[model samples]
Target: MAARIILNPTAGNGKAQKLFELIQAHLPNDVEVVRTTGPGHATELARQVADQEDLTVVSLGGDGTHHEVINGLMPEGKTIFAVLPAGTGNDFVRTLGYPKSPRAMLDVALYGAERRIDVGRVNDEYFLTVSGVGFDAEVAGWVNQHEKKGNGTWIFLRGILRHLVHFQAEQMTIHVDGAFRSEPTFLLAAGNSPYYAGGMKICPEADPGDGLFHVVWVKDLSRLGVLPLLTRVFRGTHVQHPQVKTFQTEQLTVEGPPNMLVHADGEIVGHLPVTMTVIPAAIRVRTGRS
Candidate 1:
């Protein structure tokens, strides 16, 4: 019946640690808080408690931290999960309707309704939001390597612009639920829930509880077409573009051009030849939505 919070202290430039300290005064004594020492620590913490029935495991960082936590608790687990958005881009929480205030979010994390949601598995890791390869994956690498500050969307936009100027599209073959298409590729995002790289609705129609992935595929784009097309991603209107393709599938694979970087939930995990699979109602999470 107790709750354990696995928090990434360095997330948002020490913002998560500060928020955790402040919220301690308001949390019930049964709630235990554990600060992550480094990368992958949250996953280890989460795994230790994943099998504890009736327990709530709360993720108190951004998408990266949430990614680690969910990977630890999934495949099989009984612990209910919750999130307290504290990183530069809390993209996954956007789909959950979590409150913005730390105190209010704490309330929902501890006392909200529990709902089952789909999880996207890319290779071995699990992503709660969007996962992709090609140009966007390169953008994610650029954003992660440099210093991150302020609103994450602006930072990502800057990365996108910087990479777009010199980036070359790769040849890729994407297979969605058995159908295949091969061509010069811009980027393909497989989304379990909408909202990635802060607030860009890369796959606008994604629904976490629907047991499917809304995949968005962008065809090769000329340098001139990049600006106009990318600007609409925030509004998710880019899908209407003639070169863009969107579909729903339970599984898919991307092959071609080895060493092509792949990212899941904004973290660069591995290279190409990746398979994305959706696990229906894979994890239980606390949500504020009625």
Candidate 2:
């Protein structure tokens, strides 16, 4: 079979072109490279290829690029998904144990196994990672509104501090797996993958293909109490903290302030009072983790 590499040239500070060069050096002759110009272009390209070409589709940027390519390929079962990790905050690729180094990630794609994975949906949007409404989603809106430069955990750290100072908790009513919670919460995250925001393990127990989503909601924590828990999210021990509540469900409906921000996989997707549902094992993806 052939391979098609769909790249977003603007992803990861324009490092995708360099990654394409490296992949060209290491890839087989049958693989072809295609670059996307803007939002939704990758999905359209992948869909056209899926309709006409017999090829494996590889996502060659960050999670946003992967999400777009998946949107392209989701309607048909014609392609397998692979990751090249060339974008900022490659949380999904890391979840699959692929190294961010171009050569190593390429080797994993060329040699690793594939598995059926789950994808969640919020209204009409698709999310391969976590979806949220509340404090974190508000922060996502800020992240999209401003320009972020440089890398490392500090970028998200700065955003967190900025939001924490000015952000207020919302009163939400959540129905999950036949249980109900109505409270004032600072954050509510429903996770498919274990990681978010570069590498915060918000739901360490979450299994992407297990047919259920993990939800973690923090209710009424003081800023002082919130800081250390947020810090511990990287290690995934925040779930064990006193102020956090962890639950699992197949379908969840969250209603609150109609104007609260909503995010799926780190992008500001919609406003709150949204519904989320898990499509279990709905997509086939290339992975070595499972």
Candidate 3:
């Protein structure tokens, strides 16, 4: 079978392009490499390649690149999806137990087994990692707009601090599975996998193959109250905090401030009044041995 590599040249502050060169050398000579020029370009490339039966369409960038390719391929047909972690967060790959080296990722692309995984949908878009609203989504919007110099974790932390001073909690009415609640919330995340914001395990119990979402909601907290919990998230222990709540559901809906934005896999998608549903085993992906 052949491989179609869809690459986002600008991911990880142009580091993706450099890694692409190294990965290309390991790929077969006939493999097709398509470089994306702007937003939505990867989706188009993925759709074009997915039409070919028995081909593997590999995403060679960060989570946003993976997000677009998934949208383009679902409801999927014959193509198999694979990821090479050359993006800033690479959180989705982290959940799959892949190492963060280009050579290692490329080896998986070339030889890993195909496995089915769940996909999360918000409105009409499909996300492979996590989708949410509130403080984290707002921070994602800010980070996407402003260019930052340095590592991904430092840039996100800096953005969080900068936005925290002005970020406002929203009055939200949430419906999960069939249970409902109304509260003023600082953040709400529905995760298909456990990691986001570089390495933060926002929903530590999330599993993509289990046909459910691990949803986490943080009650309204003052800036200082939110600070200490930030470190705990990396260790997957933030759920123990009284201000945080976690549950599993096959579906969820949220009604919040109209101006509040929603983010899927770190790309700002739309505003709230959003619904997320779990599509069980919706796509096949190349993963390391379990």
Best candidate, TM-score-wise? 1
lDDT of residue 9 for candidate 1:
86
Compare candidates 1 and 2 on TM-score and give the better one: 1
RMSD of candidates 1 onward, in order: 1.2, 1.9, 1.4
Model 3 residue 20 CA deviation in Å: 1.5
Worst 10 residues of 1 by lDDT: 144-153
Q: How far is candidate 3 from the true structure (C-alpha RMSD, Å)?
A: 1.4
**Per-residue lDDT over 1-290 for candidate 3, one digit per residue giving the tens place of the 0 to 100 score:** 47888889898888788998877777877678888999999999888766665788889888889999998888764688898887778898886666667788887875678888999999999998899999999999887776346556777898889988998888999987578899999999999999888888999999999999999999999888888999899999999999999989999999988999999999999998999999999877888865
Candidate 2 lDDT over 217-259, as tens digits, reads 8888888887888989999999988778998888899999989
Deviation (Å) of 27 in candidate 2: 2.6
Residue 41, model 1, lDDT: 92
- Considering only N, C-alpha and C atoms within 3 Å, which residue pairs clash in candidate 3? none
lDDT tens digits, residue span 173-247, model 1? 988756888988899999999889889889999999999999998989999999999889899999999999999
| lDDT of every model, 2 decimals | 0.89, 0.80, 0.87
How displaced is residue 221 in candidate 3, in Å? 0.7
* Top-lDDT structure, candidate number: 1
The TM-scores, one per candidate, come to 0.97, 0.93, 0.96
Which TM-score value belongs to model 1? 0.97
